[model samples]
Target: MEPLMDRVLREWRGKRVAITIGSEHSFTGILEDFDGEVLLLRNVVDVVGNRGKAMIVALEDVSWIMLLE
Candidate 1:
């Protein structure tokens, strides 16, 4: 059986998503890839007005994920 997070990540994959890895950091981008232990996001734009072409996020570090319309 798949872990809940795996199922959730699979559903969020290939879609736009916003995530907070910690209280001090958050980002919005396309959910490009996830390999159970980590996730890769493309074209990441953050709430604090920062942007990047891509980012690799560890699942353990993810505080939450919000699906973006």
Candidate 2:
């Protein structure tokens, strides 16, 4: 199977995505870019609490992705 990043890269652009990171934090945003080591996400909203706005995340920090329709 292709790597997780490859799978993410294939379908993430311009789409709304939910990302799980660490153990309790999650982010919902417009998929922006991933440059090997980091993921640049736009229009981000925190799922846990009211932490509105943009967010940039390191790839290693992500656990999984839930693609939004």
> All candidates' TM-scores?
0.89, 0.79
For model 1 the local lDDT of residue 64 reads 88
CA deviation > 4 Å runs, candidate 1 = none
Q: Show the lowest summed lDDT stretch of 10 residues, model 1.
A: 2-11
The TM-score between candidate 1 and the true structure equals 0.89
- Candidate 2 per-residue lDDT, tens place, 1-69, comes to 878777767677778898889867888888877777887778888875665567788889899877896
Model 1 lDDT tens row, 1-69: 988888888888899999998766899999999996888999999988898999998888999889996
Model 2: ten consecutive residues of lowest lDDT: 47-56
* Residue pair clashes in candidate 1: none
